[model samples]
Structures are given as structure tokens and as C-alpha cells.
Target: MRAIQITEFGGPEVLRLTELPEPAPQPGRLLIDVDSAGVNYADTHTVENSYLAASSLPMVPGAEVVGRTADGRRVVALTDNGGYAEKALAAEHLAHDVPDGVADGQALALVIQGVTAWHLLRTCARLAEGESVVVHAAAGGTGSLAVQLAKEFGAGRVIATASTEEKRALALELGADVAVDASPEDLTDRLVEANGGRKVDAVLEMTGGPVFDASLAALAPFGRLVAYGMASRVPPTPIEPARLMGRSRSVIGFWLAHCLGRPGMYHEPLDELLAMTADGRLRPLIGAVHPLSEAARAHEDLRARRTTGKLVLDVRA
Candidate 1:
């Protein structure tokens, strides 16, 4: 099998395309002939050994795959083995059947980004209908989905923040009531202004550092902010419990990987996401599609923030 292997922890340059033996079958895991793989910001961290979870050497650097099991079921799965290859291994429990009419890249999006988006609004944020929402990095995969999902779930106001005007426009088209530049220095004020001069009731914040701090300040009383990823690669300042107590605000942390331990938590939302996509209620923007060999370049574009929507690798290409 040809895979993008990282023998040492480093940058995108270290993702080398090389030949490797097919994974030996294991209990509760299924071998897949991958058609496409999702490229994520987390994969960038995985290659550098800076991800939340530790990594082993000479490993592939993908987390999700849309492919087929031996019985020929077309499925999308969170792979236990690396996904940047023609073949990979997916834990059976983590794999789900791709609905008819859903594309491979679309199915791939539902696995990680989709589920995260769903849980951020419906679970962690505990968003109530007619409440306001702010989705940071709103042009990216998870952010884009979060923007749409917030509105779908009955948010009265949806504010989207992105780095560029083009991205902001895309967010508006995806159902956001307002779109603003995600400038950390002015983010808090902009978020409040965009919400018609009111603080947001919920926020899906992934960027760390100043972005996180600013979002924290732009929350309404009893507001909830769900922190899922730190695409900026910077950690936020520690929160003072006293500060939260005064406003009755809450900061909640979420990680999709932790949900893998309980299959229902991972599958229920995924099933809803897949149905939404298949029925066209949800539209997943497909970004750049790179061949298997260009995995490194894909990582470069992702880390440089040069792309939007879902990034995919055509494994069979």
C-alpha cells in the first residue's frame, strides 16, 4: 500500500509518500479500501506530535476515511489506523453506512466535522431556540457546518466570523444572520454589534489565544462557549472561576475522540448528519481535493489557512 508516512515529528514536509504493508486484520476492526480521506487541522498537529493524544513513529496521518468494507458496504469511519493511504483500518463500532446519494467527501465530512458541529450546539452549548450564536472561523469545515446547524436548530441570530470577506459571504449564504471579520483585536465588539448590540447566547469557538479570550467576553449572561479545537496552535489564558460566577456564564470543553468510548454518542448524531446530507437539508462545502501523493501539500494549505470547507484526499488517485 502507498501511504503518507511520518517517521519523525515535524511539519508538513515530513509527510512522505511511501510503500507499506497492508494492516493485518484485528478483532472489532475492519480493513477498508479507501476511496477518499478527510484532511483536518488535527492531522497537521498529529504529524508534529503536538496533538491532544500522543502519536507513534512511522505512522500515517489521517483520522477519517470513506471507503468500503470487505463485504462491500460503502461506509465512512473514524479510522484507528492512518487514513492517508489506499487502504486503512476502521474500528467497526466507529464506522457507519454512508447513505445512498451522499458523496465520499461528504460522508467523510460527517464523520468528524459534522458530528463535532452537531454536538457543539446541541450538547455542550445546550443552545435554546431563539438564542443567539457566534461561530468563529465560520468558513472552515467545522465552523461552516456550525453556522448552518445553529440556524437549523432555531437560533434567532447567527453571527459568523472569518478572516476574509469571501469567507464571510459564504457564511451568510449558509444561513448566518450576520458575518464579520475574525480580527482578534476587534472580535468581541464585532460579535456584539453583529448580534444587534447584544452578547451572544452561545459560541462555537475553535481558535485559541486572543480569539478565545474575545469570545469569552462577548457572551451573554448564562451563555455557553464550547471549545473544540485550537487551530491557531495557541492556548488561551486560564479562566478565573470567579469571573464566570459573576456572569453565570460557562465554558465547556469538547473532544470527539472521547466519544468513541461510547458508540451511541458517536453514532446518533452522525446518523442525523448523514440523513441531513442525503436529504439536502445540510450542505457540506467540499474544498480542495488532492491526490493521495499530495498529502503534504494538503497539509500545507490547511495549516496556512489557504482553504475553506472540507479538504479531502482522493486516495485512489
Candidate 2:
């Protein structure tokens, strides 16, 4: 089987296409023949060795895949690892049959990004109706879905931020009430202004460097900010406890990988997300699709923020 492997952690160039033996099936695991694999910030983090979880070298860096099981069951899988290969292993319970009419790439999105977006709003943030929400990186994978889910969850005002006008436009099209520029330096002011000169009730913050501070500052009294990823590769500045206490605001953190530790927290929300996608109420935008051999280029585009929507590797090609 062909796979993209990173022998050492580094840049996109480190992702090398190589020939490898097919994975043998294991008990309690589904052996999947890859159709497509989702490219995510987590994959880049795994390669850079900067994620919340530690990974050893000589790794195949992909987390979500849409593929077929041994019996030809089409499924979208949450891979423990080795997702970059033509064949991979997945825990049976985490593997789900892809809903009819959902494309392989779109099915791949539901496994990680879709589930994360759902849990972030409906669970972690505890967003309420008529409340204002700010979503940073609103044009990217999770953010795009988060923007839509916020609306579906009855948020009165949805403010989306993106680095480019084109991406920002996409955010609005997905249901954000307003779209702002995502320049980290200007984030706080832009978010406040978008909410009619007041702080927002909730914020979905993933870029953990400078933007984390700005987003936290933009939250209203009793507001909640869900911190997920450090996409910028910079550790976020610590928040003062006194500051949050003063306004009764809260900062909550979520990592899908962590929730996997408590499997009980995942199933319900994941089911809701899959249903929504199946009905077309939630669409996982396909920004870029690359052949497996072009995995390096895909990583480059995502890291550079030069792509919008979900990035997927068309492994069947």
C-alpha cells in the first residue's frame, strides 16, 4: 500500500510518499481500504509534534478517513493513526456507516470537524438562544461548521472571522450573521463592533496565540469561550483568574481526542451531526481535494491558510 509518512517532525516537505505493507486486521478494529482522508490542523500538529497528545516518529499523519471495511461496508472512520495509507485500522465502535448521498470527502468531515463543531457549541459552550457568538477562523473546517451549527442552535447573532474576503464570504453564506476580518491584531475590536459595540455571549477560539487573548477580551459578561486548538503553533497567554471572575465569564477547553478518553461524551452529539449532514442541513464544504501523492502540497496550503473549507486526500486516486 502507498502512504504518506513523516519519519521526523517538521514542515510540509517532511510528508513523504512511500510504499508500505498493508495493515492486518485486528480484534475490535475495522480494517478499512481508504477512499478519502481528511486533512486537518491536528494532522499538521502531529507532524510538528506540538499537539496535546504526543506522537512518535515514523508516523503516518491523518486522523479521519472515509473508506470501506472488509465486507465492502462504506464507512467514515476515526483512525487511531495510519490514516494516510491506502489501508488503515479503526476502532469498530468509532467507525460509522456513511449516510447515503454524503460524498466520501463530506463523510470524512463528519467524523472529526463536524463532531467537534457540534460538541463545541451544543455542549462545551452551552450557547443559548438570542445570544451572540463569535467564531474565529470561521472559514476553516471546524469553524465553517461551527458557524452553521451556532445558527441552528438558535444563536441570535453569529459573527465569523476569516483572513481573506473570499473565505469570509463563505462564512456568511453558511449562515453567519456577520463576517469580520480575522487578522489577529485586529480581532478584538472587529468582534466587538460586529456585535453592535458590545462583547459577545460566546466565542469559538482555536488559534491560541495572540488571537486567544483578543477573543477572550471580547467576551461579554457571563460569556463563554471554548478553546480548542493552537493552530498558530504559539502557546496562548495565560488568562488572569481575577479578570474572568470580575465579569463571571468562563473559559472552557475542548479536544476531541480528549473526549475520546470519555467515550460517553461523544455518541449522542456525533449522531446528531451525522443526521444533520445526511439531511443537508449541514454541508461540509470541500475546499480542496488532492490525490494521495500530493499530500505534501495539501498540508502546505492548509498551514498557509490558503484554502477554505475541508481539505481531503482522495486516496482512491
TM of each candidate vs. truth: 0.98, 0.97
After superposition, candidate 2 runs with Cα above 4 Å error: 261-264
Clashing residue pairs in candidate 1 (N, C-alpha, C atoms within 3 angstroms) = none
Best by TM-score: 1
Model 1 stretches astray by more than 4 angstroms: none
Tens-digit lDDT track of model 2 for 123-230: 889989999999889989899999999999999999999998998899989999999988888789999999999999999989888898898889899999999988
Worst 10 residues of 2 by lDDT: 261-270
Deviation from truth (RMSD, Å), model 2: 1.2
User: Which structure among the candidates has the greatest lDDT?
Assistant: 1
lDDT of 1 at 299: 90
For residues 155-194, write the lDDT of model 1, one tens digit per residue: 9999999888999999999999989989899889999999
Weakest 10 consecutive residues of candidate 1 by summed lDDT = 257-266
Each model's lDDT comes to 0.90, 0.88
